[model samples]
Each structure stands twice: as C-alpha cells, then as structure tokens.
Target: MNKLFLVPLMLLPSLAFAFPIDVTKKLNGAEIVYNTTTISSNMAAINIQNVGGTAAQCRVVFVNGPENPRVRNTVVQSGSSSYVTANFNRAVIRLRITLTCNPT
Candidate 1:
C-alpha cells in the first residue's frame, strides 16, 4: 500500500512557475531612475532614484492578475531616492507596473 502511493508520486511532473516582471515607464526627461523588485509571491516594491537637478513627482502602479491595481505616489528630491510597495491578497504569478514621473 505504501509502495503504491510512492510510485504515483514519482510519476508526477514538477510544478513550477516563473514569476516574471514587466515595467513600462512614461517618464518624460525627468532624470529619474526606477526598478521593480519582487519581495515575495504576494508582495513587491519599486525603487525610484532621482539624479537630476530638480525634484521629481512620481506615480507608480502595480498590477497583479485578477486583482485591483495598486497605486502609489511620492516625491524624490534631487540626488535622493524613495521606495513604493504593494501587497496583494493573492499570489502573484506575474507582475505588471507602470511608472510615471514629472519634474516638480
């Protein structure tokens, strides 16, 4: 009986999911830099850096499949950095992000 159950488990294929991330930026010459990092299966973060001479106001949107989009806004001073994060109720198989910025 134990051998029969073990034999069926050995025939099962590996269950793996590659959670890829895609980012689209609409920054219009604001001298801003950003990157998306996956913190876990249900959480993510965005790091924004400003390397310009003026402050930048940025809007970051995080999208997970079958969930409402998460929006975050922040202002980064010149030569400074900030981070915006999102926590989802469901596991994130893939992440989509839109980053928009303007010089303030």
Candidate 2:
C-alpha cells in the first residue's frame, strides 16, 4: 500500500515541469510578446500579444514538436492578441516558434 503512494509522488516531479514560453522582440518599430503554455505533456496553448501603440501585424508559426509535425500559424493584430492550441502524441522535450511582424 505504501509503495502505491510512492509511485504518484515520484511522478509529481516530472509533471511539475511545464513549458511556459514568453519571448519578447522588437520588429519594425513594434513590440511582439509571444507566449506559450504547456497544457499537458503533449499539448500546448499559444498566444501573441501586441503591446505597441501603433497598429501592427504578425504571423506566428509553431513547428517541430513531438506528435505535432504540421506547422501551426496564428495572425495577430496591433493592440490585440491571438491564440492557438497545439497537440502532441507524446511528451515533447522542445518546440520551435517563429514570429514575423511589421508595423502599419
């Protein structure tokens, strides 16, 4: 009975590690804030925020993750945000994200 309790405790540490990505970059006089949260071992939620005062446009791409091989794209507008969800078949060690934006 004690061993059963120990198994869940041991697994807690691995589950505690979640991917939360917050990347900020300047592109064409605008600020792009990219955010991603790991909902589970094989899933993630993505978002992009435009904090600049001027109007801007951006294209966000998510690629190279386990279970999810196809690229996902999101479009964001100035002073607004966009969100997307990505799914994977298994646990992912890493993910690649790309952002392209321009000021209008």
Candidate 3:
C-alpha cells in the first residue's frame, strides 16, 4: 500500500541524521586531509592523509558525553594515509573529534 511505503520513506531521513559528527582540525602548514566515518553506535574512525612532501605527525582526540576522551597518535608518510579509531563505553549520540598535525 502507498501508506505503508510512505511510512518507510519518512524514516529514511531520520535514519540518515541519527547522529552528528563534528571535527576540528589544526594543521600548521601541513597538507593534511581527514575524513570521518561511523562504524557503529559506539565506534568511529578518522582517515588521515598527508599529501605534502614531508611526513606528518598527528594526534586525534575523540570525546563523547560522560566518557573519558580517547586519544590516538600516528605518523603519516607523504602521499600516504592512516586511520584512527575510538570506541566508547556508551552510545554516542554526538561525537566531537579534534585533530592536530605538524610537519616532521
């Protein structure tokens, strides 16, 4: 029935916006790129790429409500990419990520 189909269609938009992700980056003259992805309700990952001629050292911090902030560090080689992940103890309704990078 058309009414049944409409019910699912309306939910499609809600599912797409179930969670929101915010990213703040501080790249000091380094050609760095980052992308975020949601793995699950309590997990997320960030993909970092270095496109400059020099290597880069990056620190990533993930914060969720009422949970200890998760921190990760990685060195990305020129023309390469790396991933940083965080798993929280509670459902992540909102996620905040901070990325800081410097040329090495």
The model with the greatest TM-score is 3
Please provide the root mean square deviation of candidate 3 (C-alpha atoms, Å): 2.6
Q: How many backbone clashes does candidate 2 have?
A: 0
Indicate whether candidate 2 or candidate 3 has the larger lDDT.
Answer: 3
Give per-residue CA lDDT, model 2, range 1-104, as digits (tens).
Answer: 99999999999877875764443344666777766788776677767787877666665555544444445554556679877677766665676656667877
Model 3 quality (TM-score): 0.85
Query: Between the candidate structures 1 and 2, which one is better when assessed by lDDT?
Result: 1
TM-score of each: 0.81, 0.62, 0.85
lDDT of 3 by residue, 1-104 (tens): 89988999898855653478899999998999989998877889999999999999999999998899999999999999999999898889999999999999
Better of 1 and 3 by TM-score: 3
Candidate that would win on lDDT = 3
Report the C-alpha displacement of residue 41, candidate 3, in angstroms.
0.4
Worst 10 residues of 1 by lDDT: 10-19
Angstrom error at residue 58, model 1: 0.2
lDDT (CA) per prediction: 0.88, 0.66, 0.92
